[model samples]
Target: MEDYLEKIYELMHEKGYARVSDIASSLDVQPSSVTKMLQKLDENHYVTYEKYRGILLTARGQRLGKLMKERHHMLEEFLRMLGVSEETIHKDVEGIEHHVSPHTLQCLQALVLFFDDHPESLNDLHAYTEQFEMGSPTDTEGKSV
Candidate 1:
């Protein structure tokens, strides 16, 4: 349901409207599935839908969609900062965005801000991660292995 809202929001934002076929293709689902989800979204007051017509997001849906998009981007950026692969970042963000709490997200946002304000810290993070990956972890006192 959330995925449907996000995709529909993206399509509507980009193309000014969302079609069942376009949503289906973007989500890799059947048109029938898109229709079912759209009906559900309509029921939930998230979208206004009619057969053979365009889909429009209600204000409620728009808010959630925008939030989901922002969360997705933030998670991606966070993972990218960790040197995560693009493919992994995409997969991980999808999983993490739905499960993260608002508080945790705020904390993550703060962490991102911290890194932005202290770029040397990010470099240190990278170096620390590389050391661990190389199987030379630091000791309790932060001494090199």
Candidate 2:
């Protein structure tokens, strides 16, 4: 439901409004499924949903959607810094976003801040990783190549 709300918010931001079909398309789900979820969100006071019409996020929905989007962005940034492939970053962010704790998110945010403030350190780590990856294989005990 957080994912749905986030997508709805994003669509609304991009297009000034979000219809069930639009949300469904963005989420890659059937419109009927979107309808059902929207109805539930409406009942929960997260959104104002109307049949054959657009959706609007409530204040609570807005807050949650913003947080969800931020969390996704943070995870993606962290993964990119680690040299994760785009496909893996996308998949891993989706898998981990919902389950990540607030404390962990804070830690990641701090790590991002640190890296941003210390580009030289980040560059050194990247260089070391590149060299490590290019080096020969290690033994079973991980002693030598």
Give the TM-score of each candidate. Answer: 0.91, 0.87
lDDT of 1 by residue, 33-96 (tens): 9999989999999999998877999999999999888877888888999999998888888889
Question: For this target, which candidate reaches the highest lDDT against the unseen true structure?
Answer: 1
Question: What ranges in model 2 sit over 4 Å off?
Answer: 135-145
lDDT of each: 0.90, 0.87
Tens digits of lDDT, candidate 2, 1-145: 9899889888878999988778888889999999999999999999998887678899999988888888889899999988999989989999888888899889999998899899898897787677679895455576655
Give candidate 1's whole-model lDDT: 0.90
Residue 98, candidate 1: Cα error in Å is 1.9
In terms of TM-score, how similar is model 1 to the real structure? 0.91
Candidate 1 residue 132 Cα shift, in angstroms, is 1.0
